[model samples]
Target: MNEYLTSLDRPIEAVRYAGLTVKLLSTGDGTEVIHHTLQEGSRWSMQPQEGWTASESIFITSGSLKVTVDEETKVLSTGDVVSASPIKQGLVFLALEETEFIYISSQPVFQFFSEIVRKNQELAIEVALKDGYTAEHCKRIMQMSMLIGERMELSPGDMCTLNYASYLHDVGKIMIPKSILLKEGPLSEEEWEEMKRHCTYGKELLEATDSPYMRASGTIVEQHHERFDGKGYPNGLQRDEISPLAYIVSVVDAFDAMTTDRPYRKAMSVENAIEELNENAGTMFHPEVVKIFIDLIPEWSKMKQGV
Candidate 1:
């Protein structure tokens, strides 16, 4: 008996791994067809999987890319084709433009993406932690952001964007000077201005990947610092000018930061965190998101205490 599934049963889900956006177009039958997109200047470095024998051919659909194998670089333009499988040693690709391609493999593949995304997220967290943010700050923000998104009934795409944006909202801190990022006291006016540049830096970093999820995430990251009352940084985007996902993240991010230890101060009590969030809801965050998160606080505290 032959088994087949409809598109509804096997929907196409895009996966952003490292710098490449991948979609499994077809699978099984001992073969795999993947659609990929890489933005200009993005680099993808893949090491060979042990004992892997998946031989795949890459066909460029549009734009251009430079493939380097064993230190020899070759540029592939639109309509170009190349056979490179099992990801040979020292194989790397740099997108010269917004490149798209199709990869047909003689063997079914995947699974490696989980590890790749995990490691990348860990690296991002490590980079953020180096600046004195709590280890679990981003993780908490991401969890609450997802829950708030669900409560607000966000669309599937918006939920995905929220996940990435909330987790990486502070990733631009990597660009801030250690002196400013790690200061024990409040930032001076000039230093505060410099600190605000992180929003722009984060957007640039993630937007360069060109993946749909990351690009949307970049927009959210850029606006996550924006206040609802037009008092935010980088831009004074107010009210509806802000991305809804960013508003969700802003509430969650502020709550997490308030409730977590920092280089300059100790963590606030749960009661104080709640009060702070409520106090600034209209000015610093979206009223609805803040309300949703505030409602979730007691439930979250119970979970934390294993009650």
Candidate 2:
């Protein structure tokens, strides 16, 4: 590993295994993410070892591959996401169509999972915002969620989890087609159903990557769409049935959506968004989270006003 022209000037360069090239995205920042590209017919045979952990999450951006994790072997197609475990699992990247993926992890399956996961998260946030939400939305939700978590007196580590979880709350929306996403009218029932699938799809997409944060994030993503009144789709879980993270996200997500201009609706003034949230509290959102969210509205308003 050399530091010249490497991504971010990190002290590590590329880890090569057969026809796959794994580039370290960062190191020690705890946001481990990686960019992995595999050539056709590449195979990584794992030799059972100790003291190191590596989990391979393959997001087939293009082409196909046959990945065998332990005793299970699965064929991954473009857009398919899968993960390798800490246990001895050999992977054969047979590119059925010349595959590419942004591989992410907390500890490199071989040498750098931490950097991979962190960098991948940063990139994932960028990819997710490709829908036009902007990375600023993630920053706001992260700040707001941490503030809410503090009010509830959550543990530091738990609050950190909430921070990243909040940043990724809308990650599932990445899979939504941009046409429907940017449509200037109320979503058709079919479009609505497609949107609803993001909750489940996002979780399924991350289930294999083996990042604990991503694992925990799966639940939040799955339930962020739920309503306080059990009216949300995919799962109509209501009130306390939803996780606390989801409760926090519901408030933040709604607030952002209303406050930000979308193709279908003009942006409501912050005051109006807050008033709507307040009016619908305990019906559309958790009342407790609403209080905290409402309090932050002032700061958010100032930020939006560029004050």
Candidate 3:
């Protein structure tokens, strides 16, 4: 019997290039499923490569597209499907409008996608070494963020975004001077301003990478510091203007910060942290996220004690 798999169960390998968004849905056993979305007027060309011998079946799931195989051109609409054999000349695709389609092929063309994942992991390690405190903090934030996401029943895609955002949220600190980042005392106004630039810096760094994980989580990095009452850094976006993933990270980040020792102060007790979360709920953090986090901590503590 054959197995069934949803898109969520498979890792999404996506590339955004030349007005096209190509996602490799699955790559296994010499077969690959690709989802492609092309913007209007965008053209994509594929030339035959030496030693590449795989046929492709293209299905137009939405909008319209123009496909040219060799010298043959065909316009296809929704529900239309076409197949191209392995030829020496290859093919080209043009989106008549905003179009979406699935391309199933028998070749392994997704090695670049795996490379992106590997690069992200290496960057995370570099960031972690730059600040040991942030390294531990990120781990706790990741755990707490995932727990809250599960309680809220976020979709797999959302959870994936949240996970990456939580881990890399402070990656911008790498750009900050060690003097400001590891200062033993409170920052001067100028130093504080420089410190706050981490949010924007993080977003800019991630956006510049153009990696799929970075693209998905860049906004979260930018807006995680924003408060519900509209008084935060980088941007003053408030309330619903912030992404839900940002709100989730904000709550967990704050909780972990409070419960961990800092250069200037001792770690607050869990009870004290809970009180602070409650008091600042709906102002500094999302009220609902704060509530869920506060409720979840006791369970987390019990587990830590192996009770």
Candidate 4:
């Protein structure tokens, strides 16, 4: 890796192989380091000295794992490291819950990881379209949120998370009943409660895949509905408790929704939407992000018009 760019700058992408989530970190000298996410039901196994010859090692970062090495079984938790070794019985690794670890290998699988990320993205977009979001809407939100991200000077990893979170934010709508989603009037309290489940649903859907950006974005998706003052839903996380990416997405999400036509009402003028954003600053939305977004409204409008 270049001294100028850390591994986080290596493009936020990850791949799922045989149900295991893997993020290819860096590669050189035929050796590579990758991050792995092992869900509870998922297990990883290596055949006894199977063909590929590079030695492998694992360092568990979080969650618990059951490992069977050379007929010996042990349960390992966070901060545990399994050194590189070859055993005749091969290896069996099962996650007791959603687990994260770093794996180093003397082999390269970049091309393979890259391809799975691509396919996962393609499928995510398709899933979004099926749930009633127009392609243009998703694009505008992504562009606007990224603009806010840029203004905030978020790190490369954070900016990527913001972009993807905005794109997939509404995916949870898929689980809502079409009657409720397409209703021409405001939702009743009961319906509103059900509708809000989209945030939780969105997180679940995104977490099911290996795409690094998508999985990372899931946190923002679930928190975008939350308010800075602690009145948001799914979970009442407030103040700095929310992800900054979620805050940026929340502000941009509101701006776009207000200024665009919806089944429930006609679009609010840009001035009104701007006013709404200002009115809620420091309470409903983060004041800083709202200011940054409002400051860039003209530029945002140009992007919206272009879209």
Cα deviation at 30, candidate 4, in Å, is 18
The C-alpha lDDT values of all candidates are: 0.71, 0.63, 0.71, 0.72
Q: TM-score for candidate 1, please give it.
A: 0.59
Model 2: per-residue Cα lDDT at residue 61: 73
Q: Candidate 3 overall Cα lDDT vs. reference?
A: 0.71
* TM-score of candidate 3 against the unseen true structure: 0.58
Model 1: residues with Cα > 4 Å off, grouped in runs: 1-132, 302-307
Candidate 1, residues 213-267, lDDT tens digits: the string is 4656788999988999999988999999999899988887777667766555787
- List, residue by residue over 1-307, the lDDT tens digit for candidate 4: 2223464545756675433677777778878888888877445443323344566778999998986554467999999988655424434566899889988877654554455345445544554433324556666677677667767866555655665677768778777787777666678999999999999998887776644446677899999899999999889999999998888888887888778775446789999999999999999999999989899898778866873
Give lDDT tens digits, candidate 2, residues 1-307.
Answer: 2334544644556654324567766555343566667665433222222443655465667777774444466787879976656534323344555567766654644342334334435544554433345556665666667667767865444554565467666666667777775566578998888978878876765554644445556777788878889998678999889887788877887788777765445778877887899899888888988987777677666655645
Q: Tens digits of per-residue lDDT for model 3 on 182-279?
A: 66657899999999998988788777652344556788999989999999877899999998889999988877767766545677899998999999
Better of 3 and 4 by lDDT: 4
Clashing pairs in 3: none
In model 3, the runs with Cα more than 4 Å from the true position are 1-132, 302-307
Cα deviation at 153, candidate 3, in Å, is 1.9
